[model samples]
Target: MAPYPPPQEAATSTLAERVGKGPDQNPNDTITTSPNCNPNGQESPTGKKTQASPTAIPEIQWYYGKHESRIAYWLLLSGAKHFGYYPRGTFNPFPITSALRRMENEILQCLSLAPGSRVLDLGCGEGHISRYIAREGSFPLVLGLDITASHLAKARRAISGDVLRGFLRQGQVEVRLGDYHDLFTSGTGIKMGEWDGVTAVETLAHAVDTKLAFSEVYRALKPGGRFCFNDYRIGIPDDVVRNESDGEVDEKELSPQQRKTLKAWRWVMRTGGMKGSEYSYAGTYERLLKEAGFVDVKVVDLSENMRPMARWFWILSLLPYAFAKLFRLEKAFYNSVSMYEQYVEWGGWAYCQWSATKPAT
Candidate 1:
């Protein structure tokens, strides 16, 4: 994909001009301070007081900080750390970089923010999506928050490079080391109704309390502001589906193969620092968004768009995964296991994009 224009050039273009009209929009690290903001909650160059650094979750740090995990993300994903979106009818995954850009465009469209809007990107791993929003120029001020120090270091370096190259304004994009849950708490300086839009891409799944996280995002958004995100939802077999609040699968109903898949799924989620039960139900997101006072909630299934990339990962992992299993190196190849389980055992997974608006009143 072509590089985005410098901030000055981008400012002269309309959003439509920057993002072509189409579904297919052809587009990791150690602890460090954000480019334009102190990671320790100091006042930023833009005069915005950032939140205090939240205690990093050890599981998350251990997982993403692993040598194998970093290499896998960099080699396969170019440090994007998210799935790509192949347009419907385009099953081939060769153009994965473009597909990844399309997925970012999807999120941008869902946000639908006006020029100069302020956005908060939770779990802004490597700050890829956050920088994308800034480069689009619609949201000139994009603040990224992530708990991982290594990822923040990488984000800082990238943002600094962009600023130095004039690709971004000095303080147009700033990332801080913080947690989404503490976004609106006292002393954090993140005021209620402060953000024009908030985005979390595949990050909320790691929140131990998804409802609390939703509430925090709702509080942080301005009245009538939008919250948009992409995440995974567990799919239940029709025969075993029930209206259970916890959304736990009934192990007894599963065949041995299904049981094995579930075990692998759990392992993947656990190792990835995700709260599996929070994502085990389809309607959990809608319910939580409503409970958090968001209106006009909408959820779109993007499973088909995600399938190509999942399949791509599965194919890439086969040989390595076989060796992993042979040598009991499965833990080192947890990402491979995740792809395999999600692709072959997709009956238990669903990829979704969701949007909800804070009530205007």
Candidate 2:
């Protein structure tokens, strides 16, 4: 065989094949995992820079706080690997695969971005959305910030050679590692103002203080500049489900099983070097945005039209997760499995992408 061709599919697969196994795998294992899509069979706890963080990762409030959850962060990285990525959903006539594009387009349309609008992506994972807007849409600038150095490394690497001067044209979308929740207090140290718009995507709820995060975003934007995002965040109070929360994890209304699953996820986050807080699926985000002084908030149903896909994707993504919870393998195999699943070629989630504005003068 004259040098087997190559994966040529993705950099990740090719990189995975470079060594006998993944970076976390042991060299002692003789069994090869190349053919297996789930290649984490031999992965083990990599004591790789696990000093923990203080306010980033939500599980361990100690030494390994957020600094240890590198695996969980890969979930976001997988999405950013592709510019036109849609979180697979189950809705028909517009299944998760099809509707995701429509959903992103709807959100962009709702924002009414101009030819050269400036946008900011808070917690911009791998800067994929910003990359799309910058390279494809020709935006003026799209700045992204995060708290983890590893994520920033991947993002910076993805931006790659000449990305600043070439593909993006204006060389916009600078991805820096910083804490969005406390940017204002810390004073970003960069020239303030000149921001045309802002976005958070699926990252705002991670802040220990959602109100503070929105407030910072409010302070960062130019008047009338639009701010938008589409995350599985909490909606305004309505005829959904009754809630009686003091904003604590222990007081939520989810089933015991849900709580257990969430806890398991958090544990993995700590081990993998990512940041997350309690599930904000029930918090009052609409009211907080209003309180933060954002005008013309549009919390549309990103999932209503995709109910079918939501149900299907929920099964594909969450069933195994539920099983992990039941078997206590969440920390063992589930962590890697869930991380890998996040990279599945396609999925359908009744996702919500919201658009809000800063009141034009």
Of the candidates shown, which would achieve the greatest lDDT relative to the real structure? Answer: 1
Clashes of 1: 2
lDDT of 2 at 100: 41
lDDT of each: 0.73, 0.48
In candidate 1, list every pair of residues with a backbone clash: 1-27, 29-150
By how many angstroms RMSD does model 1 differ from the true structure? 8.8
lDDT of candidate model 1 versus the reference:
0.73
lDDT of 1 at 3: 75
lDDT by residue (231-268, candidate 1, tens digit) is: 98766453464444345667787777767766767788
